[model samples]
Target: MIRDKIRELLKKNAEAETNFSLEKPERAEFGDYAANLALVLAKERKENPRKIAEDLIGKIKGNREADIFEKIEIAGPGFINFFLNKDAVLEEFKKLSKLKTLLKFKTPKSKIQIEFISVNPTGELHIGHGRGAFYGEALSQVLKLTDYKVEKEYFINDSKESSQIKELGKTVLDEGTSYLTENLKSQISKLKTKIKNLKLEKPKNLYGEAGYLIAEEIQKDNKKFIEKELGIKFNNWISEEKNLRQKNYFNKILEILKNKNLVYKKQGAFWLKTSQFGDDEDRVIVRTSGEPTYFLSDIAYHFQKIERGYKKIIEIWGADHQGHQKRLFAVKKALDWQVDMEILISQVVTIKKGEEIKKMSKRKGEVILLKDLLAEVGKDAARWFYLQKSLDTHMEFDIELAKKREEKNPVYYVQYGHARMASILRKAKSGKISPPATFTFAEDAEILLIKKILEVFDVLEDAIKDYQVHRILSYIYELVYVFSVFYRDIRVLDSKQERERLFLVKETKKILANLLRLIGVAAPERM
Candidate 1:
């Protein structure tokens, strides 16, 4: 909102179209906000940048009468720096008492569907899947907090023809009917122990029977480990098997593709003209063996999503499926759907303990389970570590660091700041201290903490626009660090400034709690 107000003023004062950049100045002396509009307009209009900045400042001063800004200055060739009035800043701090009502952000009235961690129901969820689950859950919370109608979904890849499911069946049959490899032997032993009635004899349709058993086990594990342990609840659990069984669903999709001239039969196989829609090559929807490929089912699933009337659909996919993105987009183009669809690819998670990199392979039964990881650290630490990094980049999750109870751990540090603030408030309340009608911020640390506290709203807005949830981590970390400095340098209990300091501590705690909750991490009152 602050950035928007500044942009409006810049646009109104500019004579021509200009693309400018606005951001907080790195140094405190530079000002609270900085804009490069004069530099951009001067480059476009061939005018002196300093002169343009002066002219823009004049217009801003003439148009704005409110005491929102304390000072506006030009510096360093063309940049315009703005300082907010201290009264305005304090007013924002006061509003934090009713933050939810005061910061009622306006968002578009549209339904959005977010599908994430939709792994095939063939095995237990690994650490990589945990990353996706945490990221998706945190993103959903962020969107909801910003006033968006959000639907979180888990798309189960459990079709009968799935290659993974078929492999699982083969594994089960091999273990049941013959000697099992060391890799799969343990899993089959566990499965047999769990399902007492599981027959050791090979069935007539081993693939179907074994696949069903494994899929059922996977679903059960997902409910217990993923949903319950990790606290991620899905609004929809879409089953590919169910969708595939829907009468005429696949056939209807084929017909739609045929009507659009997007599919053709050749060499006893059906192909979609994906290359025409920016894909590298045409992709097969149906094989020569008379079985539909997984791609066809995926297209149908997306169609179902659109049919449900979502204005936007966001798919959080693993980086391994990056190549499939274009083909899916081609399917959307073939259907001529007007809805917005985005595929957010999450990179791999590399787990490490000290200097040793832990190898993870699900098929080999050599992977860190999500439940095990949650047990090792905690839900809050796991979620924080998983989400504190960018989704598009590889993350190295250090087990030892995550388990630490010191400042080296970011989650602990942030949560400690919150706990520390809560202690301060309790002390103030016990002492019957009340905030003064007016206050003065004399200490540099005090002013710095207030400035950092005021920045959460801007950070939240930027995260919503860019879908970069990691930025919130950076903001809260800095806020906590500043608060730590304030606590160490300034006294709070039994001082003349005790009440005023308590107010700042309370506001800081609110922001820290909000940010932690947004990331689905707990904000403990005591550590």
Candidate 2:
């Protein structure tokens, strides 16, 4: 909020020739915050930029709000840097402790829908999907914290197209187009024989398509199994085919586009003039066979979001789907809707088994399922591992590291700090010990750790405001690193300053709990 006030001042003082932007200084000595208004003005004014910066600093000094700035200094090349006193930092902490009281700042809220992990139901979730799920879920939480009305959703593909995909699987297995065909005879025979051998009820005569059906049944079993095993659940499971076919929304949108001359007939198919909106080429909305293209259904689905009255719609997609963005943007522009759509791209995942890296393939039965990873490492560690990195970076998942029982895992390191705090609190409660009314922030490491704790709100605000989950992860790691150094030299329950140290530990746990909750991770009191 103070930052907003400072921005207003800069805007008021800015001339037609000048613009100012706040930038984080590379080093604290340069100043806590810096701007380059002078550099932006010099070209138009044809005067020395440093002189302009000095004049601005003098003007800033006379303003009443100038108390917010402890010192304003002109740095190299006309960079004006401002430093705030310790009170400014503490004020942020006080405000954060009462963050709920700050919601009045955001008014006239709009509904937002965030759909993530819309992974097809053909197979179990893998590490690749996990990134999107964790990141998207965390982002939704951050959005809610910022006072945005948010709805979390998942779009499941369980329709005629899904049936078509099942048919493809069935066809690969020599099943019938609608029923199981002959190619899957052997698997069917094997299943029957195994069922009979186990003294179970006899399986049906349908071989190929029946076999594929059986396979799908087994995969659904895996889905449920994996969900419980991985502790992942969705708020909604939307069947795309059913939704698309039920209301004929796709045809309606196509007709509207056709009427508006946005759709053109070509080669017995329909195409959208997507190239007009920066797309490399026009996209086909319908195939020659009269079947709607995936793009058509996607456009219809996005329209559904707009119709649902969600002012903002966010979709988390894998990197391979980046090309799809242009077409989606084209449709948005074509409709002239005021909706905001954001697509987060997640990088590929590499799975490692000890020193060996293996290719992941679902058809070849070599892919590592999310269930398998959770089973090996467990839900807490599994979730934390994925949340530790930026979604844009290619993540290397080493099974060995994940399966470790020691404190080598970053999650454990953070959780240990929490559990240690819990242990201290439990003992203190048992002995009826009380913390000091006034705690001292004197030790170098203690001061550093406390200052970092005070910055938790800032980190969360930055991550939410900028959509940078990596920044939050970085903040967590920094806090842990600082606390680790402090823990090495300080003891909480046994030290002479036990009460104050215990209080610090309690504060750390509370902050860590909040961080873990925001990222959809559980902070266990005992691990």
Candidate 3:
């Protein structure tokens, strides 16, 4: 609201005709805030910036528009900086105190289905898979926290893909396929024929794991290793094989698109006229081989989601799927649906041992399973490490850093800060210590910690809207570092201000616990 008022005043002034940007001053020696509007205006008007800044400062002295700023100054290169009363900074703490009883953001009031990490049922999850699992799960948590109607979905790609088709064909033929042996193939064929002929309940791969038996066996220990390491879970596991084949849904969707003339047969295969809807090129829905492309069944699955009544569909995909976004949007446009879709692209992860990079592959034995990372550094450490960097940036999983498991570890640092707060609280409870009636800031360290801690709410909202989970991670790590330094420099318990310390410690724990829970990290009592 305050920011809006500033923008309005800047827009009203004809001479100060540029956009206003409020920034904190470089140092305490200067004003607490700065704006570079004069510099922008000078460039536009072709005048000296300093003279323009001076004119604005003089005008601002009596202007009610500048009331939000306690002090404003013209800094180097015609920058206007403002300093507000300390109460402005303290206001955040008051908000934090009330956070226990209040909600900050309004609800979207629409159900959201986010499908992610639907890694094929073919292999164990790797570090790359962990990125999607963490980001998607964290994004879901943030939305829920902000009061969005959200559901987590895992689209199990068990059918129609090259990988799945190969696996299924191999399984049906029983040509050394993993789970579908000769006996299993015969059983499945008999069941398939039975389903076609009988009106009774048809048998199926009720044991989905049975299909992945061979792949799992080859990477048996590695699969367990990855799961234990990543903490990945799905609320809904929708099997494409089951969903695509459900009453011939794929054909049913194609029929609808065909009737709409949104689909066309070209080059001996069916193609979706995605280019008509601004896609780079028309996408093939069915290959010349008579097999439906993954996009064809994807349309069916998306239609299934729409049928389920989700107004919003969010997908978390790896960077490699960047080009896949246009086609998905094309489906939405072709169907004439108002459903909103947001796809977050998670960058790749690199495994490093000491200083050497260790390449990982799911097919090759060279893969470093998620479980391996967990075994080496524990879950909290691994997650913190994985999420510490922005999803848009490639993450290097440093084995040496994780192996240290020291206070230097990003996760351990945050947990230790939380643990330290817990320790302070325990001391207060044990000693029955209390402070003055009125809450007040004392030491510089105490104020610094409070300031940093209060920013989590803002960061949470920012990450949710921008789809930037890494910002939350960065904020938490910074908060922890600040708190740790403050904790070391100042005594929190057994002092005249012990009650206030107890309050801060309690609030700190609340934030740490909530944030850690959201990011799939553990805020341990002791570390």
Please report, in order, the local distance difference test score of every candidate based on alpha carbons: 0.81, 0.69, 0.70
Which is better, 1 or 3, measured by TM-score?
1
Q: What's the true lDDT of residue 382 in model 3?
A: 73
Distance from true location, Cα of 189 in model 3, Å: 18
Tell me the TM-score of model 1. Answer: 0.92
Candidate 3 segments exceeding 4 Å error: 1-70, 74-82, 101-103, 160-163, 171-233, 362-365, 429-436
Write the residue-wise lDDT of candidate 2 on 287-390 in tens digits.
99777777888888888778888888788898879878888887788779798788888888888888998757655656666766777887777777787778
Flag regions of model 2 displaced more than 4 Å.
1-31, 34-49, 64-72, 87-108, 161-166, 176-227, 361-365, 405-408, 427-440, 487-501
lDDT of 1 at 66: 34
What tens digits encode model 3's per-residue C-alpha lDDT throughout 1-527? 33344456555553444455654344755764466788888888899988987887777665765655667677788877665544554555665666653234675788889988776655556678877877787788778776667888877666533456456535543444543434344455655543233324323432233343333232333334435545555566676777665558789998999999988887899988999887999998889877778888888888988888898888889877898988889778878877888888888798888779976654454666665576777777777777778888888988788767577777767777888777777767546533335567757787767766755755765677777888888878887787777778877667676677777777777787878888888888886
Model 1 agreement with the true structure over 29-142: per-residue lDDT tens digits: 889999999999888889999999999998888875435789999999989999888777777666555565325456787898889998777666788888889889888887
Instruction: Provide the TM-score for each candidate, comma-separated.
Output: 0.92, 0.82, 0.80
Count of clashes, each model: 0, 7, 6
Error of 1 at 158 (Å): 0.8
